[model samples]
Target chain A: MAQVINKRIILKNYVNGFPKESDMLLNASATIRLNLPEASNAVLVKNLYLSCDPYMQFRMRESKAGSFTPGSPIQGFGVAKVLDSRHSNFKKGDFVWGLTGWEEYSVINTVGFLFKIEHTDVPLSYYTGILGMQGITAYAGFNVICAPKKGEYVFVSAAAGAVGQLVGQFAKLSGCYVVGSAGSKEKVDMLKNKCGFDEAFNYKEEQDLDAALKRYFPNGIDIFFDNVGGKMLEAVLLNMRFSGRITACGMISQYNLEQEEGVRNLYQIIVKGVQIQGLIANNYLHMFPKYMEMIIPLIKQGKICYMEDIAEGLESAPAALVGLFSGRNVGKQVVAVARE
Target chain B: MAQVINKRIILKNYVNGFPKESDMLLNASATIRLNLPEASNAVLVKNLYLSCDPYMQFRMRESKAGSFTPGSPIQGFGVAKVLDSRHSNFKKGDFVWGLTGWEEYSVINTVGFLFKIEHTDVPLSYYTGILGMQGITAYAGFNVICAPKKGEYVFVSAAAGAVGQLVGQFAKLSGCYVVGSAGSKEKVDMLKNKCGFDEAFNYKEEQDLDAALKRYFPNGIDIFFDNVGGKMLEAVLLNMRFSGRITACGMISQYNLEQEEGVRNLYQIIVKGVQIQGLIANNYLHMFPKYMEMIIPLIKQGKICYMEDIAEGLESAPAALVGLFSGRNVGKQVVAVARE
Candidate 1:
């Protein structure tokens, strides 16, 4: 048996509110055995890219069911290559993406969740975003939940981020008039130019979100792909058209708050006969094969585009993850743990 | 042609917030011609039962659409008898139910919305409730929006009121464990004993609505027929089960408030993967024929029961309508303006 150095990011404590970089610790001194245990079904893999998602913020809190324990390596979605495998489904040379540890190498006992990479012609880092959970989230939220019709008005918040950018593009492909809102001017430009949205705005600059929504969606919003869920959601509720659909994918704005902002205009949902539904990507995993079948060709044809804000090493993971809340990332934020 | 003195309840001014008896005037000096005009497709009717519904509160305010004009007669759903007719669908001596004025006699020009009563075996006042808009509201909200399954947990707020009482019975008929919340002890008792709810609670007595909900529904609410939308709605959001459905019928609690209460726990809708939908009975009018077919049998067989708090004469119409805000009426409130 041989020993190898493993760099990891560990949780310092159960997070109370907005997570700071100091709440996580970076350790390069930990060591792991290169050899696997006999008769075990685990696979040992070297992580290449780790995804920073808003839902991961919930895992840092003190929840009885799914929260990350203090002093443990924070777990998230990542792209990895198997170094060794005792599982029949995976091999030493197989590249995969799934739930993995925030370290250089992880012994993954969770065999069912791991998916072996089939298409490698595109960027391998995309396995963390476009080919993984984020892709399926955009697919299910827009296509399945919203069920948008052509020429409908579609609005997306956090529209420059991973799932939102794709949702805007999908809306356009469906012949919908799509508008998106981002935090910065650069991100807003990226939304309109790169993501193919009909219009985009810097929500941070708008003093009155209701007036902003009215200006953009003069006809009223038919489908709202909501990522942020505070005052923005409240404003969107007022401007929604009759029989509108709202896909409540993530409430990134409320996740870090001590007390979430109260939404006042929910009464409007009744007057308009709207349907607001919540969705989780994990529940729609069965649709991944269908999603890849639809999305892979779009990516190959340049009809779909994706962007990643990559940090250099495992040491940059804490800052990269924390940046998501403040809208520092231009697109999907990922940490490059190692190069193949 | 003879002239008749028709007493009416007229709006004194455009109401801003909670309505008072003084906001409406009892006009007994107004007179109408007993004869219909030649070549006019209108029916002159004597109002028998004027339904006092919660939605009428919105009409008292100054709105661009649907609000009552100052110095005009208050409009509402009512059961009436045709004293004279120039319309082919209705003739003299025909009993009908539709939108009519809150007066002793009204010349109805809109015949399309009016339905001629076919079953006179039941009380004519039943046309104001179980056989009319309120019946269809409960049918559409519970059966259409909620789409509940057997053995599921169902919750109704304002549970002894017009639509709420019917919704509880419908949920029970669907083999669900139904719980209802009312403002008073008598109403709570009526929900459990008369409406056949599995359990009932006086919301005024329960300081912690969430805890009360937890006590009744240890599993979690599968369907929530929301009538009181302020704090009760906020509490129900926390106790909903995964993929639960909520029918946003009426927000009686919020209607009279100058500034409606803000709902804080809406984030729970996302965590539970619930669907909250708004409904208007008018949109589902096509389903009316089918609704009556289903409900008439239930009413005939004594499987369905209804209660009405009837006020004597047109003089009490203002107080009866205003009483709905304070939960003063025990059941479906109606004003007996005249005998058919």
Candidate 2:
């Protein structure tokens, strides 16, 4: 077996408040064998596209159940190619996506989270977002949890992000009057003009969120896909119509805060007979086959569009992940570590 | 047709913060006709037991949709006897329970809310609590929304009150480990001893609500029937189990505040895959018959017990309603206007 240098990004230390690019270090000292050890059940993978998500911040905190360990290769959802496999379910040349390390090459012992990529016609990098975990999150949160009906008013916060973008598109496909809010004008314009949202706004420009929501949804929002929690959630509670539903996906707004912002107007839930349902994409992964079946055709037909912010190399992974909090990424942030 | 004095309790002015007894005035000058006018589609009722509910606080605010009008008789769920009727559904002397004025007699123009009282085997006052909106609220929120399973841990805030008490009993009946929080030692004891709750605590005495909940629900709460929102709801969020269900039945704690207390820890909803559903008992009225079928047998078999804090006379109605905010009432607060 030939030895190869493995370049990787490791968590420098546990994060406090917002994460910084310096919190991670690119290490090129590690080396790995091209072949797996005899009798080992581990699968060796060459990482391709690494996802930079809001949830990755949670893992950067001090080690708990799911938190990333200091000095360990920070793990996230990524698209990878199997170089060698001692596992029965996978083989060489197999493309996959799931929880993988922020590295050029790695040996995965835990094969439970990994999924074999069946459809590669629509860009393998799509496995990092629209065709992967982010896609299922938006699908399950909007279509499954909220159960959006035709002609219903829908509002999506963090609407230009990976999950939010897909949620807005899904809501529109459900025949809903979809409105999205983003941080920048470019993202807002992209949401409205590019992604086919009925309306989109730059939340930073709005002084009063409640008034902004009311202006967009005068009759009141029937469904709210909340990717950013805190003030936006409080404001959405005020504008919710009777029996409205809110899907709690990621709280990107409060993830870095030492103390979470208190959500006022929860009483509106009772008054308007609303439902706030929490969503975890992993729980809905069983629907991946069905989701791909529905979404792939939509992508091919131009009914669904996805935007990506690709950072060129493995070294740029830390900055790409950190940029998510400051709203620096225009779309789905991905660090392309290798071509194959 | 003959005229008779109709002594009533009228809203003196729109309430601010917590309601005061002075907010209501005893109006004895008004009189009503003993007979219905020709072609009138109304039912004239002699008011009996008036229910003192937490939601009445919302109606006490300035006239809006579903708000009480100043100088007009307050309206609420109550048991009454039809003195005269031009509505085909009712005849003279028909016992009914629904929305009625806080008065000796009321001429109801809208008879849609009223339901004919079929069984008088139990106390007629039960119609104001166990057999009316509160009963259905407990049933729909617990059985339908929370969907309790055997061995699940359940927590109810305001557990000694109208709906909470019933919910605790129902949870117990469904083979759940039920815990309840009240404001007084007497109410706590009653919840555990009489209501069949596994545990009960006085929330007023617990300085750290999150600690109190952690102590009670060490394994995390599977179902939370929330009546008193605010800090309690926030604390409950921290202790929710994976896929936990929270039914937002009421927010009595935040009702009186001009500005609602912000509920922190909403992010837990996503972290734990929890669902917080808002419940309006009216929306679940279709389940009333099924609920009554399940409950009537339980009540007859002594499997369910309800506690009542009866306030004698229409004069005591104002005080009874005000007392709910301060936790003065030990159980289901009811005003005895006239015992038929």
Candidate 3:
């Protein structure tokens, strides 16, 4: 077997506050063995689409045992093709999506989460977002946690992001009156025009979020899909109707803050009898098959839509991941590591 | 039928901040007709035990239409005996419990919520606390919302008050380890010694609530029945375990503040996968019969306990109501206007 040159993106050190492209070092010197080690369950993959998710920022910091290690290639959800496999479930040329490194090639030891991609009709890059972890996150958070009803008012923060975009669309499909908030006019326009949101607002331009919410949802919000927590969550709390549900998917705004902003209107939770719940997509993996059953048909029928901001090449991985924190990406950010 | 002099407590005006005894004025000149008008569904009752609750503070302020009107008799849940009735469901000498004015006598037009006291085996005053709205508040907030499993760690704030005390008892009966927080040492002693809480602490005496919660809930809190929100809620958020449930019953600490204190640790809701829900006991009225079925046996068997801080007369109503904010009264605060 011929020796393949493996280009990898490795973190220089544990990050402090906002990450930068300079924090990562692109190495082209690393090489991988084409042959698998004897009896090992590991599967060697050629990475295709590397996901740049907001949660990857949490792993970059020095945390407990499970957090990403410094001087190692950062790991995240990605779409890849199996080149060699010692694992019984996966074979050569198997298209899969699971946890992988920001590199051209990755030796994956855990094959439990690696799902063999069956559908190839749509874009393979969709597995990095709408068909993978981010897809399940939006699905479970909106459908399971928020439990949207027809004609109910729904508000989603970070509405142009991967999970937020899907949640807004799901609410719309459920016959809900969906409104979304983004950081910029372009993203806000994308939400309204492209994502089919009933209304969208640039949160940065709004002087008072409470007034903005009151305007969008005159009857008060029934479901709040919160991606950016802190001040927006506080405002949403004030505007929640009786028995309103809040799906706390991510807190992108407060993740980097040393001291997170205090929510002042939590008392309204009692006043309105609201339920605010936090969710992680991994916990709801059992519902993935059911979720795919619902979403796959929608994709085929053109009843649903998704947007992506693809950055070409393995070297662009660092900048793509860093761009997520600053709201620099327009949609689902992905790094195209390889052609196939 | 003769005219009866009614000694009533009237709101001087819509209160701006923390209420004082002077904020309520005693009007002794007002009178009520002992006889019912033709075709009237009104029931004239002699008020006995009037319950003073923390939520009453919200009604005291000049807010929306539901708030207590200025220059009107202050109304609340109370135990009363029907002296005269034009309603088909009730006759003279029937013992009932429902919303009634804070006065010596009241003519209640709406008797829908007025539950006829069938189980008088217990004290009539029990209807104002253990067997009344406060009891149901604890039952619904704990059993319905928290949904505790046996041996789960339960933490209750304001744990010696009307709702908190009952919640602690319910958690204990479910085979859970219960801890409670109070403002005074005596109440703390009452929580552990009388209410059967495994542990109790005086939050006022503690220098750091986060440290206190960390020390008590070393394994983290599974269920938190919050009566006093704000800072304690922030601390509890930090100490919550995975999939923890929080019942947001009240925010007594923040109610009087010009600006409610901000909860800085709301991001923990995501970190720990917590579900924090607010409950208005009135919405769970359908569960009252089931709650009573579970509670009546506990009371009759002497398996459950309750405490009352009783005020002597109608004149004491203002002080008793005001005392709740200051944590002056122990257990359920009740004003005994007249004995049955």
Candidate 3, residue A104: lDDT: 87
Candidate 2 residue A90 Cα shift, in angstroms, is 1.0
Q: Which candidate is the best by TM-score?
A: 3
Q: Write the per-residue lDDT of candidate 1 for residues B56-163, one digit (tens) a residue.
A: 888998888999988989999999999999989999999999999999999999888899999888889988998999999999999988888999999999989999
For every candidate, the chain B TM-score is 0.98, 0.97, 0.98
iRMS values in order, in angstroms?
0.9, 0.6, 0.7
Q: Distance (Å) between predicted and true CA of B120, model 3? A: 1.0
Docking quality category of candidate 3 according to DockQ thresholds: high
Of the two candidates 1 and 2, the one with more favorable TM-score, higher being better, is 2
What do the candidate models score in CA lDDT, each in turn?
0.91, 0.92, 0.91
- In candidate 1, how many Å is residue A69 off? 2.4
